[model samples]
Target: MNPFLLQTEVRLASKLIMPLKLQLRQLSLKRFRLQLRQLKQTLDCT
Candidate 1:
């Protein structure tokens, strides 16, 4: 196995993983916001 090729593969995986992580974080944040809104509305109604 070539060291350079291995390094390149690792870099590519890292790049892909970063975006996936970011997307997961964004989705979690959005979900939290939606839940918060629902909770607030329920509280207001009560």
Candidate 2:
């Protein structure tokens, strides 16, 4: 295989992965916020 082709493929794969990584991070952050809200609600009730 050509080295240049391999490098390009890697670059493309990384480019594709970047957005997926960002989306996953955003999703986890949203989930954490929801959990924090629930914890606050439970604490308030107590």
Candidate 3:
């Protein structure tokens, strides 16, 4: 395989992966926030 081709493929893969990483990070943060809210509600009720 050509070196340039390999590099290009790697760059494309990284570009694709970067957005997924950002989305996953955002989702995890949202989930964390929800969990904190739920915990606070439970504590308030108790």
Error of 2 at 15 (Å): 0.6
Off by over 4 Å in 3: none
Clashing pairs in 2: none
> For candidate 3, lDDT tens digit of each residue in 1-46?
8999999999999999999999999999999999999999999999
Query: Per-residue lDDT of 1-46 in model 1, one digit per residue for the tens?
Result: 9999999999999999999999999999999999999999999999
Worst 10 residues of 2 by lDDT: 1-10
How badly does each model clash, as a count of residue pairs? 0, 0, 0
Ranking by lDDT: 2, 3, 1
* Pairs with backbone N, CA or C atoms under 3 Å apart (clashes), candidate 3: none
Query: TM-score of predicted model 3?
Result: 0.95
Candidate 3 local lDDT, residue 9: 99
Query: For model 1, what is the alpha-carbon lDDT of residue 28?
Result: 100
lDDT of 2 by residue, 1-46 (tens): 9999999999999999999999999999999999999999999999
Q: Candidate 1 vs candidate 3: which has greater TM-score?
A: 3
Q: Is candidate 2 or candidate 3 better by TM-score?
A: 2
Candidate 1, residue 2: the lDDT equals 100
User: What's model 2's lDDT at 20?
Assistant: 100
Q: What is the lDDT of residue 23 in candidate 3?
A: 100
